[model samples]
Target: MTKEQIIFLHIPKTAGTTLREIVYAQYAVDRITPIYRDERFMDMETFSQLPPEKKDAADIFIGHFAYGFHQHLSGNRPYKYATMLRHPIARGLSLYNHLKNLQFAGSEISFSELLKNKGSQFRNNQSRYIAGWGTQKMLETAIQNIEKDFLFVGITERFNESLLLASHDLGWQLKPYKRRNVTSTMWATNYADQLRNDKESMQELQKLNTIDMQLYEYANKRFSQQIASHFPNAVEKLLHFENRLHQAA
Candidate 1:
């Protein structure tokens, strides 16, 4: 049987960098196409124009794009999609900190201010990315896509279990690796302290991402069902993976 091509829809601030490393390690360098944040190949116009041979040679496509890319690509091969979702509030905070770290041109704006900005992309970003639209239909379409099309949907809070389930489905022998692009624990602790001290701001941020919060809850429930239905020994295997990961650390 021909192996299905893997399409990883890497949502931001969801431990995607670490997962990308694990997935990439399983494939030969020449057999994978990493779209990542590369501007040249990010848009559909450029991605669709890749030489047919390059598309044919690649077995895995990892990227930050939304769901529709699979339909646009030129190929008859079957594709299996997977993605991880983060709690909307947590994701928003992480994104805020990441942008702050980069000293973005408008780095001085408060997280709440940024959320209120009309042009801000970070608000309800997960829902927007998954649905590819800004209307109520986007949330409906995103839930349907996840339920009907994705082979697996995972939650960042349950990272080990998610990886174990993905490995089981893909028939890969995955091992834990050191995390990449992580926010430091010290900074995270400080941020958490600030949030605790400012409940109003935190609440506002949560209110702003209502769509993402709903989507995340839906994804989390489906993730649990997927683990239950598909990976019977998921808990056991996840425990083993976590133990090994700790020892390596």
Candidate 2:
């Protein structure tokens, strides 16, 4: 069978690192097209900028990207697009905590200060700011560019199921999913701190994450509707998919 040409766009704070690792492992076995992270391929000016040479390295593109990517997606490329989403609130919390940890590593800005200023500095300067600002801006960009591509959208909340479907589509052996990069003692408390120290910032987080919230809600609703429309017994299939995975582990 001809190998399916695929691209995995790794959006920030989504289970992207884990997915990228999986794809990298598959690519090494000659199971998929050659792919790597190149910055030149993605031409967006905001958020984090990737190196220009990163684009020339892959058959399947996957990384943290913004709008206008389709213009650069290789043509005649039979492509399947896959991405994972996280709850906007959860993502926002993750981002904030990540930045605060970095501050301990030499960043001078206090987490509370960053929260108070509304991410103006982070958004304007950093390569990948987690202030959770402008999520709609990112989503709208992806939506516009990926309209014609074969896209598979999944939520991190349902990661293993999504991986099973993706592996099946790509004709790969499915394995039980494992959590990657989890530290034994690391915990999440940054957002909780905000609730105590900066009520205003918490509110902004809600507002900034509005787009992500909508995107997730819409994607779930859309996926459910699509499954129900196309497969007469989709709920059963989904439940079975979950049950089998659970039982196997």
Candidate 3:
């Protein structure tokens, strides 16, 4: 093994936990899972928060925050950076249902109310971290800040394909597919009744989820170009993985 490490920048509700599990299994390396108790750093503005010795120790760092790995990247430390994203509408709905579960258990706000005021109460992962509210600023930020050398940027809609691309990059033959965030899926299905019953609520949800709708549209359009840039043989690799799975079945 060449001993190069991969940094997985996990975006919330994007099947990231499942991806991390697969990566951990395939690579046989400890994965960085974000829990406040774990010693992994979350502070993005401060470099010193992540101790140099700790940075040198890990073969893979996977978490729900952004740090450019300056020490590793600038110094030829043999690190590859990758991130994953979900369609905005799907991600927003996932967040809503998650919070709505709390409402059911006796939070003051109703699911309908939350949908109406989504811009304030709910933070899209981008809004929560990188940019502010549902503004064009997010698009601008993404365009400006995106790495030209992102090893792989996984799209949640085509997750299996994304994994094959990442596996190929890591020189692994394993395939990752179908596993999803169980909690998120359950919450959505559980709350489907609320959505079905309230027409006004659904309309509010559409307004609140405008950012996600836009995100899905934008990502779907740009995905092909993104794949071509890094994974020249990505289509063939995905087809190969599909064939293997079918043969196994």
Which candidate should be chosen as best, given TM-score against the real structure?
1
lDDT tens digits, residues 1-249, model 2? 114445555665566767767776566533333223455433343312434344333446565543234445434445555567677666666566656554444456655567665463323211122112354455555454344444566677767656645554554445444465432115544443554356676666666655556667766675565545655765576676678768876
Encode model 1's per-residue lDDT on 4-34: one tens digit a residue: 7778788888889888888777788788777
Residue 163 error, candidate 2, Å = 2.2
lDDT of 3 by residue, 102-182 (tens): 544456676656646554544445433333224456655553444443465668888776666566555555653457565
What are the Cα lDDT values of the candidates?
A: 0.74, 0.53, 0.58
Clashes of each: 0, 12, 1
TM-score of each: 0.86, 0.65, 0.69
Give the clashing pairs for model 1.
none
| Alpha-carbon lDDT of model 1 | 0.74
Return the candidate ranking by lDDT, descending.
Answer: 1, 3, 2
Superposed by TM-score, candidate 1 places the C-alpha of residue 84 at a distance from the truth, in angstroms, of 0.7
Give candidate 3's whole-model lDDT.
Answer: 0.58
Q: Lowest summed lDDT over 10 consecutive residues: which window, candidate 2?
A: 122-131
Per-residue lDDT, model 1, residue 160, is: 81
Clashing pairs in 3: 88-212
